[model samples]
Target: MESKTGTTRRDLLRAAGLGLTFPLLSACGGLAGGGNSSKNQAKSALKIGFVSPRTGAAAGFGEPDAYVLDLAKKSLTSLTVNGTEYAVQILDRDSQSNPQRSAQVANDLINSDQVDLMLTTSTPETVNPVSDACEAAGVPCVSTVVPWEAWYFGRGAKPDQKDAYKFTYHFCFGVDQFHNMYTHEWPQVPTNKKVGVMWPNDSDGNAIRAALGPLLKQSGYTIVDPGAYTDGTNDFSAQIAKFKAEDCQIFNAFPIPPDFATFWRQAAQQGYVPKIAQIAKTGLFPSQVEALGDIGIGIAGGAYWTPTFPYKSSLTGVDSKALGDGYQATGKQWNQQLGPSLALFDVAAAVLKAAGNPKDKLGVANAMKTLSVDTPIGKLEWGKGPNANVVATPILGGQWIKSTDPKYKVDFVLVENSSDPNVPVAAKLQEYKP
Candidate 1:
């Protein structure tokens, strides 16, 4: 193997006193060191593989992917590394929101496409399996959106394991975040402090059940767990019946999107509506709640990203307002995926440049281990994160408020930002009347 050692982009830029900016690889300008023609003539180019749930129950997460990818393509078409201009190609695949399929596509990217780096996001179903594949294949990977505790322990990793997977790095909130977002919202409404928790047998459900349930108990609230059920259980009558029997005034759940939609409708029909129905792993997006019609109003969940967030994209220098405005201007609703998806590319581009050798997988992996850069969500400090290979993003409380706006039938307002005060609170907490 050729020697994979040289100056990193961060080193060169800092030496010149230029902070992290994308203008170094300007779209209209020629290559940094060599001309554009030489970049095309390079024998090998840097390859990046992106995987997400584009066409499945969780497809809402990938709705803004195309726009973000288009932005990435334009900004990352070419870059200068160690005085050599290199062409960059990004390969995207749909995980279909299935763990098995996620692993398959990830394997193809590593072995077949020989991707120099891998990036996956959205949820544990997409992030965990893809990260596992990258770890087994020894390919450097980065992921986002999934709760950190779920991504770490959900993969059967222990808290004492430390750096369980070196080649894979993740950035997202953790179980503590969910607890914070929930406890902050639950007390706003009058209740008996009895929380009805519906945790399934899946990764998210198991992790939340283990951590979040105890936290609620410690906070002097009674937790009424109905036990773990399968993912696609058509009937939640038993669980609903238990909550109703216990007179649970506050409801919490971590379930798949479709499963929550089914259980939510059933709960309403069965007259088991709680004063505060805070859900996780589902109902984060507007479209998901829109499916619930008016019942979606007053439902609550955690928010990691929002159009109203006060942050900017490192790639396009686009602030949260511009990013959301651009999407809305194009006839598309704003989504949480926009920030993290663009952040993935921002981190990817930074990792590739910091690697000093884009073709060397080990070098790229090492670069990702300590890489830190500002993103549309905020500054991501991978090195300062919870684990050696993780960065904990902020999670705030939010609710879906009734609205007649055409852009969105219901408005996803930020109700609590105690965890991340930088994000302004958009509305006051409203008790769930359903």
Candidate 2:
């Protein structure tokens, strides 16, 4: 967990398939401010548990999240709240994208590790149980990647149940936001182009499909029967063939990393190049594009942050170039720049500042409820009105611009910069498919 002087060493390790590991409390000693009673410490060190998929099909996204958490934790040592020093202890567990395993990890983090707060980016199936555990324990949990709608309205209601979850907070945009962006902006896209969507058969996929139905109807586009793939399936040739049969002009894929890479590569191999290709989650990380090589060229999707975007906030001083450079200096190639992680950390900082003490979970949750801080993305305030879940925040979008510079050897474009979460759908969906 030692911070490298530059990102180069870490990048080399990541490229070599050697994942980074955080130092355990026993090994790090008092460096991370652990092993001391809250009363003995000037400001209690907050132990924030993170349950993310580190060694699963979504590792491309999960790994960067873990790295971002590490960076955030290191950054916190230098942060001061009202001139009082504070520290952070990040307890990380890999969910492996399995619901049962994720539940075990959740229970351990909450009941055994006694974590003050927890952060998650699990898929819908895995997230529900964990959210239930946190809610029952009265622990504050923040999820950066879980679709907001699923958490707000439980997966199809049972015969006799209300659809709502009270304890989980969503910090990222929901599927409705992304779907609205596309549907509202369809008028801007040339008419008569066939739209082929390939979404996973899960809660995330269902949500997108539910939103797409009304949007496509309103936009006057012929929706080719979308193809559905199981979450971990590799072969997409049959699905691609269906799009080819429909003479698909635009392709929208919502699969995770390796599958996304496989689909894009196969599409190119089969000469199935759409006029414009759009991917949902693939563009979020740089590694996904890197894994696909030239196959990912011209692909557009919404992302949280990128190097080209302006950071219009006092929290980070508004210089995105320096942040990108610092990330590059770590020896890691700046691909999917860590947008959500940075924003989440800023939120964590706000929570700590408001609580005035890290050991108080209830006090921290109350403080979070009142916080309205400006972040690198934009000003974020907890949703406080009646019927508000209190754990979710607005989402912004960015594009991936292809970079050819040898200094930055990556081919992805972040054309659309991150905007405020509430940007009108028409404005947010400005087409970048060309």
Candidate 3:
């Protein structure tokens, strides 16, 4: 893995195209064990571990994680809780999106690197072992992309099975959110009621299917024949033909961004536009929007946060604008999908602030359980039900309306807001027409 030296505060602002005059670099004295420091003060050099695949197939996801972590570290120093000062040090680990490598890297972070906390993107194949390592070490892990069920139910073993790993927490809404959007929301479209699903035959796809398959039948929806496909089989023409044969009305896709784009182009070329299509994840990133061009229009999808939604102005006395602005200044776009990286930072910040000291993992864990920090996405509360880490955050359903601006190719129409946990799944279904 390639590593770079840490940047100074000034360098970060310059990279973000912002002007900075604050003497933040010199303000480190308080954090560096200077005057009036207590003898038992927590170690000043606070280190947080960041593990992501910065070099493999998921580099698109991993690179942004690293960039966003750097951005958050730079800005979070200005944050304080009850007059306590803290500094963030990031240790980068390249998991390369492999399970064994992810486990090894996670073990290193917990055992040798002495990371106060761990931040990671969860893949079903990779996250389980890493979660086990963290659980064993008593480390608090805040995963940006791990699905809610992985943290809630524990993936490898049955929900009732013993020896289940339970140290990690999911910071983002996972397949359950997707299932809610599809089973509950997509049915609302009166014209295009039929559902067609095309997913990769991998662990990620299986997890999604496991959650949605049973629900689809229970919801009285038609499951088109020849549903799922394995990875590396580029041609989706056969599957498109099946959808055409089934007269599928609403096309639902869960493939990765590149495969999703290819499937979309193939479907378009085959004259198979299913009144409207609802896609998840990869389809919502800015890169997908730019790559697919006009072919990407009219597609509806769910997202955690968007620049479009309104959030609380005050978040427990923290400036929400500063957080949002810091994120926007980084120049990363999420198609319509809100990057979970920012949410992960908020989770970390919440734990850090509540703990008052950076070195306490148990304190961080307890703080996370009760955290209700407001973010640009809205007010977030960790689910206090059976599941601990899964929070009831807002998921927005947006349309890819034709762009009015020549420079920008597409814009979003906020069709409906699915923020409320009490909002009936049936009602969300009724409102979310593709």
Candidate 4:
């Protein structure tokens, strides 16, 4: 897959004016497609723009992006659509973990590059803005990694509306899945059922506070929310004090990595220790845990993708174990984001083939509206409920412990799978001592 860096004035005009694919894309200009319009308009190249946070705070979500892109480029040398062959170009831009940059790069991809489909992942900071840009430009977009509700509702897609965003589609776990996993997983730690929450004043934080908080309360767990705080707040003293006062044994948070690290270190210093500190978003990566030293061990969180999964990548034909092993061959630790990063391309391949004519924007968008495709994670089928545009994937609960292997310093052991029976529990849940 070729990357788009820039285009000359002539190139821009040609890209802007052309109703047909570039001449270089056509393999002998074979007439391939069923419909008359498709026969007349089967373009040669399909361009997809990918947005992610390759730098800044959320960089962990994008560390393996380049490796995954290389894998996709190798696997998908060219796509055979109908009877014609079409080369694929994936132009990726880093959001740098900033939302405004996300919107700006997405606009550039949509306007300058004239991408047919847009695929973005990481967090709402990246996904929401990119999706918004796609929705406004009438481009087809598929995003994962962000919570379904945060992407769906956080972007001002009304809950009561019959149709959510028309151009963008998302696939990730939702509040219901969080409720199911939390209710099942937390009971194993022998806590008092009091959950001390630090939901930030952001997209992910707001949605979880409004939705997951209530579910936890209804499930007989007392909630100790300290209200919403701004993202880079240094002092968590007041919040820690309250949790200590209430004897909150189960700590829950949905914050950016730095904020979480700061709060966690402060909590340890102030003696507001909990029995089960279940963190989301921040604790998914091994690097995040490694940064905390011994304090990070025994901390629990959800696993969106692990080597234990039985699913295989459609493009690479490598199962979860092989994918992990392949990445580790580079002497780097395996990350949870690897599966989702490559899965974005997997979804792109599916929709491109389903579009009939890869050049047709509206047709490709419509195809993504109801798509069932395989990825490194699992089968992602849209048009099911949580919302019309979302597919809730399985999230397994696990804890970070000292690694038994020499190659790694920490290991994540899956302790609960009631949310997903297909994945077996890796080990028993341990109570938090630090």
Candidate 5:
């Protein structure tokens, strides 16, 4: 729950219920009574609010956030707009990995702190709610980490719709990108094409079930879905039995971290190991896999970002390896969320600077629509994507390998890069030997 500003989001919640809501209201209320001069002087610095799930079930996404935020603040401390030097103030808030809390903090950022721009990350749990708040409040927002379809259609935007939400823009891979990765990697493992799926009755799971399921089925694969289970479910014995009975040798799931850990352990104990456990959502981070011990080896997952990616940060010009090295140097583990998290700031800086007026929310949001900038995850082109406000990043396919390498406990090696060939393949896809 720690933040780069020396204060945690939990501290704000404790000091004032719902993240300084009452106090912020009172303070802003008093500010409204001030003369025009005082109000104008308040615009001396540009305020940006960054929200993420720093705690709860998805806390791993925020482990290196504090460090990244500190780096962002140092590099983007000041910028000139219209010949005026403006100091930048970034207020970080924790979503607690809950949708309600995500919206509440975003509201406070837009209305209370008067942030000109908003940035949110992690998953649908945090991104959807924060995007809702920003879109409703007419604040320019940029988000990453979540799938594009989950963030777009999960919020009720229909397929092929352009500019469905004008104020909010998202940059990440969608189900199509995942489909490409899965189809490319699954064949290498040599399965019976009967894939077992765990589709929870949630945004990410549902979206994958509806979209990815059909894609696989169209490609002549038999899908064995055990109905939709809820997140945080403890027992997966029934689901394992169904997959075992069907003799399904390939498994895939887009679930939260803890649920995957629980189900995988149960599946192993039940002797229902699949040839390729092409899991998503979870298994992107090292700690999640390390928790599974030897069972974690050869577990295939989609890679959104990796240290070996051939890209550099637009803000700092630090390449993928350098960024990962700097993070590992902090005595912390390397994660896939690092590149996209930093890309959020890179896009923020470009959007605000291109706006010509940093204080004008509408101007900045408009600039983001046509903006294309080179990020750590490669070039994010808003105009070239399926949606006007959505820029699809590459979704590489990789597997977690249990290694004796001194640097990593479980190393993720790239296997497929159909979306972006610039990302090199580090290893060939291997069958799970469980």
Candidate 6:
């Protein structure tokens, strides 16, 4: 590691960061480091294991990964710890958006590759299993994108569990963020306050349904929940018919990319379009909107990252605009995953340096338990978050619309930011006309 650069390229000599992997070592490796043995491992190149969904349904979140990894490769070529410099290698893997694969890759990184630290992200499917693998293996891990509640409780961790998941920490929005962003963003359009929610049977769906549904009800809106549907179900006729029959004027959902697309297209075909189709988990990217052709124009969703955010990546010292511009240079529209995905390594680099020795797993985990690094998304600190092992990052409300800009076919305009007013609003809300 070099003080000037701070990190180096992690190789695939074995396998992945997510457009979300947000690093590794094993049981007999850095976990019990000290004296000459510790020094020996510290002198070796620091290996980081990154996991994400690059080839599956959640691929939208992985779109900016290559660009982010490229920047990390250039900026992370060297790392400095306790005045000692060591080479860095980042090994990234693809979850295929499957939780089982996520666990397998994480185990491979920890037990096989002997990664020093671990970072994974995107959704619970990718984040939870990878985090769980690290937790069981005693490897320090960090992640983002999924709601904090989903990552925490969904992992069978209780609020009073006392020091739950010491090896794994998380940073992302929670139910309260949805209560704020949705309550503030939805009222922009005149409605009867009737919301149709389609929560799935997965981790994200279960968490949202348990917390967010009640909040919307307390806010004086009538929630019509169609119960939990299994993921990858191509038919949503029953759910659509219920919404249409109830005359629900607003809609909400937390589903994977393909599931949402299938349900949404089915809803439209069945004549069940809502005025404010506030969505989560999906519809946060430009290509997602482009997939629906014109139907995606006014559909609303939450943004975990965007170019308008007035922040910068700590590793490359590139702000939101610079990051966005760099991706646009690649001829791809900017994505919300760009900031957080890159931020994962930003925190990883900081954690490695703060660990005093890159090879010490306990030191790395302890550092992750407290280290707060300024990232492209915002300030991500562990203890400062909602729980000891969680950082409640900001989530803003936005909508997809036609883009006059030559580079993009559709533009994601920020319409509400009450969750974090520091994030400036770009445009007013537009009602989705069926």
Name the better of 1 and 6 by lDDT: 6
Expressed as tens digits, the lDDT of each residue in 1-434 for candidate 5 is 56443555566667676566445434444234444546666777899999998999889888889888988998899878778788899999999999999999999998989898999999999999999999999999999888888899999998768889989999999888988998888888777999889989988988888888899899889999999999999999999999999989989898888899999999989899888888888888898888899999999988888888889888878888988889989987788888999999899889888999989889999999889888889988888898887988889999988766786788889999999998899888998975
Positional deviation of residue 283's Cα in model 1 after best superposition, in angstroms: 0.9
Considering summed lDDT, which 10 consecutive residues are worst modelled in model 2?
A: 19-28
Find the candidate with the highest TM-score and give its number: 5
Alpha-carbon TM-score of each model against the true structure: 0.89, 0.75, 0.74, 0.90, 0.91, 0.90
lDDT of each: 0.85, 0.62, 0.62, 0.86, 0.88, 0.86
lDDT, candidate 6, 201-291, per-residue tens: 9888999888888888999999998889999899999999999999999999898889888988888888887999888888988888899
- Candidate 1 per-residue lDDT, tens place, 1-434, comes to 21133445565466457553334333324246444555556535888899999988789898889999998899999878889887889999999999999999999999999888899999899999999999998999999988898899888788788788879999998878777877787777889999998898988888888888888789889999989999899999999999999999999888889999999999989999899998887898778988898888889888788877888877778888888888878787787788999999989888888999887888988887778888988898877878888899888898888766765687788888877888998777789985
**Looking at model 6, which ten-residue stretch has the lowest summed lDDT?**
19-28
Model 5 alpha-carbon miss at residue 74, Å = 0.8
Each prediction's RMSD over C-alphas, in Å, is 10.8, 12.0, 10.6, 7.1, 8.8, 10.1
Q: Give the alpha carbon lDDT tens digit for every residue of 1-434 in model 4.
A: 23243334465456547754343223223223333445444366678899999999898898888888889888887899899898778898999999999999999999999898999999999999999999988999999999888988899978786467778888888888888888888888787888899999999999998889888889999999889999999999999999999999999999999999999999999988899999998989888899998899999999888888888888778788888889899888898888888888888888888989878888988887789988777899887756668888988889999999998999898888866787879888889986
Question: Is candidate 3 or 6 superior in lDDT?
Answer: 6
Which is superior by TM-score, 1 or 5?
5
lDDT of 3 by residue, 38-118 (tens): 433445556677777665545456645644666566666544656655566778788876778888999998888888888
Residue-level error in angstroms, candidate 3, position 50: 2.2
Number of residue pairs clashing in candidate 5, backbone atoms closer than 3 angstroms, sequence gap of 3 or more or interchain: 0
TM-score for model 1? 0.89
lDDT of 2 by residue, 93-124 (tens): 88887778888999999988888877777466
Task: Tell me the RMSD of model 5 versus the true structure.
Answer: 8.8
Runs with alpha carbons beyond 4 Å of true place in candidate 6: 1-42
Residue 115 accuracy (lDDT) in model 1: 88
